[model samples]
Target chain A: MSASGYVQHYSAKVSDIYFIRPIKMFKSRFKFAQTKVAVGALLLLSCLPFAATAASLEAQLSQYAATAKAANPGFAGFSAARGEALHTRNFASGKPDTPACTSCHGKDPRSAGQTLTGKRIEAVALSVSPSRYADPAKVEKWFKRNCNEVIGRECTAQEKGDWLTFVGSR
Target chain B: MKFPTRPVSLGLLVLAFSALVFSRAQAGGGHYYPPVVDPVVKEECGSCHLAFPAAMLPAASWKRMMGELENHFGDNAAVDPALARKITAYLVANAGDAAGQRYSAKLLRGVDAASAPQRITALPQWVREHRKVPDWEWRHKDVRSKANCTACHADAELGYYED
Candidate 1:
């Protein structure tokens, strides 16, 4: 097959499976390398929205709690913890050239700040920033984009629920 | 179905992905994701730094990109059909509204079609979040622009933010 066809076939086939080890290991190391001052600053700034919508944050938190509980009844709480860890973990895959979520957003969700490049990010999980999580489409759009960047795949419903729980707990 | 847990399944997937990438290469391709730089855009617009993400523009916008080549930030880089087609396809496939719709946290809270083009770098909300950093910071000797999202966005290449 042609080169382009090869890539197409490979990506298609891989899509049929789950996460692989080598890819996971490579991602972890890459994540470690990206945690410098500048990138960290960018992460802080990127999470600014969390603070903007504190008013209704409580309601959203409750909703997340319910959703997460329903998604994984046995380990709803543990899954939240795992989701938190996953959010920050970097999967340095070859497809999308970017760092892990933690590379910019700090390991701690409570922190807010700037990035290495000066872009602002909100602490999405910290506050409800009335405007925060207000738009489901926008949230999904970024999740799709960011998930591909960090994990080289889409975030599973379970992962999303876990993430919601962790954010809600915060 | 649940994600593959078996080693054989994982291996098969890897091989499959590799094969897909290779075949894509042989079928009229150079780089898997080649940067589509227009000549005029290169001389004038790119003179400042890298051009904006192609995905920012739609097919209509891409056509505009070609037409405006000569006037691009002041240079002309009209791309031919074949290259443009490939570039356009990639861009459209991953356009801000298209690919981003799947997991954009911002998109999640709002109406389905709320933000037409979800360019995080260009979003007001995003800018407001990072406005405190100061433009000078983004223009650091090493940094590029406030819009040069790839610089700081943890998952820029994937096209959105994870944090």
Candidate 2:
């Protein structure tokens, strides 16, 4: 806006909120508030990508939880410990090549993993790969494929939620 | 040092990729293969393995492979019929015998395209090239799988598999 127009608007706001202050002090306070607002907006903008990722991941978990709850009224929340166990637990029923999620995803969630075919898989830990679980379709596809490969069938909603919770907590 | 496991829409970038492949081929180098460019093909094929260059195999090979994705190398990689068709078409169109392939010509030598070979690692030329690699190197922790080209060929993601 033109300087004069901005000043007129600023004066209107100043009188409404800080008219009790001296004119000279009001001018300084306005500068401080402007800087604070700019900084606040900048911080919020910087966090948008991360916030969106967090929301999507949480939504995905809740979706699974809802499904699980509907399937079994006794369903409780997911357990990180149980998820961690499932992540590393070996299954004898599935493909021998992928006995467990750890067989391909590696032992550490914070590091990269390698598929049986030697392709690299990004880290599963949300802290290390925050954007990895942002896409519901992509996440569900892998869960279906990998769970079938590792556990011999589609993962239960509880299992999926727990796994996501564990990974996200990481 | 992060390689893009999921390729974006680089179908249009094939010309640039081929230029690089062409230059490397002119150096009398036959170690390069064009990385998969089609996003669908790349993601579907590359998720569990390198999206191997379709030029590495003949049309018959891809045709046979795509026909049996349900038992693909003992993995249930079955996709929807329509999606499978798209992937099959891409692979068949770029197969070593279907396109202007010079690098993979030697690799496919002595193999009848009609036979429809399944394993690129089992290719005669591929075996010959790696004959000198010690068993220990292949058994190394990082290079445990033969398909892990990036384990040794650092630029494997970019299609260069230089010795």
> Which prediction has the highest TM-score against the true structure?
2
Residue A24 lDDT, candidate 2, scale 0-100: 68
lDDT tens digits by residue: candidate 1, A1-170: 69999999999778655567667888998887777766888877665555544434445445555765776676443366777887776676713334667765667777653444444466756343335465554556556655665676777666765675576567
Please state the interface RMSD for every predicted structure, separated by commas. Answer: 10.4, 1.3
Tell me each candidate's TM-score: 0.34, 0.75
> Which 10-residue span in candidate 2 chain B carries the lowest summed lDDT?
B3-12
Best by lDDT: 2
lDDT of 2 by residue, A64-155 (tens): 99999999999999998889999999999898878989998899999999886578899999999877877898898888888889889999
lDDT of 2 at A23: 74
lDDT of 2 by residue, B1-163 (tens): 7766446446547878999988876844877778899999999999988899998899999999999988987778888899999999999888889856666777888989999999999999999989999999998887888988888888877878875
lDDT on C-alpha atoms for all candidate structures: 0.53, 0.88
What would the per-residue lDDT of candidate 1 be over residues B78-101, giving only the tens digit for each residue?
445675566556555554345542
Off-target runs (Cα >4 Å) in candidate 1 are: A1-78, A94-97, A113-117, A128-130, B1-163
